[model samples]
Target chain A: MAGLLDGFLELLDVLLRNRVRTVMTALSVAWGIFVLVVLLGLGRGLENNVRWMYRDDAVNSIWVYRGRRTIPYQGHPVGERLRYTNRDHELVEARVDGLEKISSRFYPPIPDSVRWQGKIVAADFRAVHPDHRYLENTLVETGRFLDEADLLEKRKVAVIGVQIVGTLFGDHPPIGEWIDIGGAMFKVVGTFRDVGGVNEESQIYLPITTAQASFAGADRVDQVMFTIDDAHMADAVAIEDEVREMLSRAHGVSPADRRAVRIRNNVEEFVRVQSIFDMLAAFVWLVGAGTVAAGIVGVSNILLVSVKERTQEIGLRKALGATPGSIVRMILAEALLLTGTAGYAGLIAGLLVVEGLRRWVPENDYIRDPDIELSTAVGALVLLVVAGCLGGLVPAWRAATLDPIVALREE
Target chain B: MIRLVGIDKTYRVGAHPLHVLKGLHLTVPPGELLAIMGSSGSGKSTLLNILGILDGYDGGEYWLGDALVKDLSERKAADYRNRFLGFVFQSFHLLPFKTALENVALPLYYQGVSRKERLRRAAEHLDQVGLSDWSGHLPGELSGGQKQRVAIARALVTRPRVMLADEPTGALDSVTTQEIMDLLKRVNAEGMTIVVVTHESDIAEQCARTVFLKDGRFEGER
Candidate 1:
């Protein structure tokens, strides 16, 4: 409720009186804020990298891989491990409540030499269910996804990705063309365009029945993937466990032998990764807060010295009948001026550094480009003001509590 | 009017206490010009500090106008100083950063006067001290005598009941010192009480009465 203009003018006067001190204090604050922003940006970049690794895959989908179990049976460890059959997949599909979409995969162990027209191309072929379109998040740019009719009819048809088409046909419209896969002819039912190389576009896909009869030759499948509904993560996990129990009972495999049948839940993976990122962010904040505290300490030390040097001036004012409150305000104003200026300077310098790094640095390299977000700027300003106030309080108290006679005698 | 009865002040250095004012008694009616002449360590500055309410006294009954100056709290002491006392230092403590006009207006500012009124009064006081033309000049830009005139103008701007000058002419030349004394005399004749502290007998002779101090007690009245 005091005269704000007077306080502001007085603050300007103190800062002007000690230009070097003021600038130094401001620089420290600015550097502190800069470090904080840079740290946050680094954390965000790391999170982005992790997300990039999982792109083209369902974040909400779970995969059940074929694994081996090492358990003792009859005083010797069991060998070769148990294998999953189609019946286990069917049992889970019937009982699991949160099954949004499901797909099974079977890869041919040997590579296929495919021939189109007069060209030959190497292909690692797989037979995947049609629901793979949903689980793999694919877009059929040129043609369309394989239908359930294709699976039931057991047709000798192929869904070829754009890369395979480029390798085999070479600028030719490949649809309806016959391709020779391991001496057997199959029609290219669809040609797929590029979908970031991480999806079904990476290879050739055929009917599960054809793949089982041809290259892989074994009747057993390789893996199954289930995409769960986003809203059913918590309840679906427990239900998935029940489905696993049912499948284990049906397959007559021990529940403890994980190799018999392996199950994964995306919600669990998401929770684990989320916690790791949280911890990383907390560590970054710790370092940033420490840097900010160091800057505050530097400002406070300079302010204390400034107050000491101005003792005689304070005495003269008191002798002229300046109230204690005014003296306190004067010292506080000086502190605020020093810290606030330095904080803003630090912010600008930090942003400049971040921008330079962003422009000059390459992607996927060290030292992520800092983001000067609005929230970060506001947070830094608030921290600086608080630091300034705490820094000024002691010196201001001393000045306000000064005895005029003692101060005048301070030569 | 100012009156002092058995005012005592002591300073504690290390373990020993040095009494600077030993049961001192004095009085000065309105419009009187008085001087206290004392050598170094003879308590002249201490007495001035006590009278200005800038220092606390051990025991005393000091009154200015109808108010008791001694035994007042810090805030009230400040109020008393602002209401009735003005000071001029030998070093011309005119706040070197400010112009003469700004320095002269400070006391009135503390008195809560309007800025326009304070500036107008400060201008008049500067004209009285014959530094109307130097109002815009900082203390560093002015001569020693001109600085003293500014300081005198600052002291009198509030129209205090008493003006205290601690060796007001200590830093000036003989001619400038005479000029400052003449100004003080003119101000006293205009009905403002004045007390000056100086070791120079010539400066003391300019006032109507002079008191000499030795060993923390008044030696005799002159």
Candidate 2:
């Protein structure tokens, strides 16, 4: 270590002797590090933001939405068509094996008329079974959530979001308070905290029985949500296939026209979306690594020139008594110092630039604000050092192999 | 004592080989001032290089103290070059970036001497060569004579057993050359063996013994 330190000091003096060349080498290394850090940081930001979006929902949950068919009836083609019934929802709930939880929904006819206090706030009334709390990760902040008994008895109690309390009562409790939906008074049995985002907060929850009878005027459901125990359960796929088969058989729609009903897995969709971000991250890595490689190549070229310029001096040192190992170490140390200092400069600059960008950009759901993580910084530093060492190798070897007698004779 | 027996050296030029030294036999006791004189391409520098252990001869037996120069390993050869021999070049090859004192201290640095001791000894050597005031001056700042003096200081700082000078005064004016020769004579008188390679008879006359070479062999020794 002492020998290494001594060699390092000697190299420092040598590099300092040619300040311009040393500075140029360092700058090239700095540029490489800066590019690497920025690209990787942005990639990481994308990955983190995507994960944040998918955390609240169940991994194995699927939503099936009703679609219209364009089949001709008698003579003229039907302009619009709707096909789904509440009996299908009930049949699926009872017969589907491996179903952890199932909930049916009805879109209220007067969606925009719901009001808290005297303020008309935008809200969607969803008819849901009692099991929705566990499947959707909803948290009840006040009072009690609805149960199977309420749905069976056709109760008018509603579960409201935290936004209703803030908009209607000014931070006061909304539980047990009467809220009017389309001129019909309903008691608020529970107020849920905001679970996911704005969509979850702007909703009103009602029992499926009351919603189907009151809104659509028929025993019909627009959508059904199913939560399975394991995403990979054989029955999960079978349940989707079997339910679609049963619904088509019951609705008199051909199984081949299954496009009328769309089934989507939240977990699979999330993973697929996350993979797109991961690919984007990989692209960032490739671009950053390429930039660093360019800087390393530049440094290596400069060091090659430096070796040629100092051939005579190297020969003289060898003649005097400096060992070849000592000469090699001196050259390598100079390369490392140039790379390390320049790389660190770029890193600090990159961090400051990212932090500045972070301050200006608002939080976005899809695109994350840029920031630096410690592991990435350390990885970049290691890459810079390795690049520096590689850059010096050929020149150091050339210096070490110099013949003193021939070198002293060099003009 | 140093001995050279049946020494031969050759150089490969294009596809042919050029012999420089052929069966050269010589011996020098400690504190001897020996001069070798020869025309251009007469192997004067080749013999000096071999004796200083800077280059190996194709065929030779050179004994310095207990080590055979021809058979020494690369590491041992460097040790011999550092501990037992010093060289003075005609160009006064002081490292251009170093001060006169730093150039003189290089050998001591390789010897692992402390920086203070090396600097002190280098200054002492420079003072003996009559350039004490030029210790901090770089070679570029010095005159021809002053640079040669610094080279002489460097050669003597290691206190090696032998000092080999290759046309040491070749680049200087007559006055500067005379000063360098006087310095060499003084160093030789201090009990260090000296081998000065020159083509000038006047330079050879300064030594106690002189050898003249023709072709690749010595003509005679006096």
Best by TM-score: 2
Measured with C-alpha atoms, the lDDT of residue A326 in candidate 1 is 76
User: Which candidate's DockQ is highest?
Assistant: 2
Lowest lDDT 10-residue stretch of candidate 2 chain A: A72-81
Per-candidate DockQ vs. reference? 0.34, 0.44
lDDT of 2 by residue, B1-222 (tens): 788899988899889999888999988888999999999888887887788777788886998867787766767777788888888989988888788998998888788777678889999998998888989998999999999889988988898888989899999999988999898988888888999999999899989999998888989988
lDDT of 1 at A385: 67
Cα error, residue B163 of model 2, in Å, equals: 1.4
List, residue by residue over A1-411, the lDDT tens digit for candidate 2: 134555465567677778888888888878777777777767777877876676677766877877654454334233334556778778888877777888877777775656766777777787788887766788898898889988898888899878766777786767788888877788899988665877787788898888767665477777888787764553455667777777766765555766655677674676567668778978997898788777777878888877777888887777777777877766777777778788889888888777776677788865576767877787867776787588769777877777777877877
Kindly report which residue pairs in candidate 2 clash with one another: none
TM-score (0 to 1) for chain B of model 2: 0.95
TM-score of chain A of each: 0.68, 0.71
Model 1 chain B poorest ten-residue lDDT run = B108-117
Error of 1 at A186 (Å): 17
Q: What is the interface RMSD of each candidate, in Å?
A: 2.7, 2.5
Runs of candidate 1 with Cα error greater than 4 angstroms are A58-62, A67-87, A90-199, A202-222, A226-283, A367-369, B11-17, B114-117
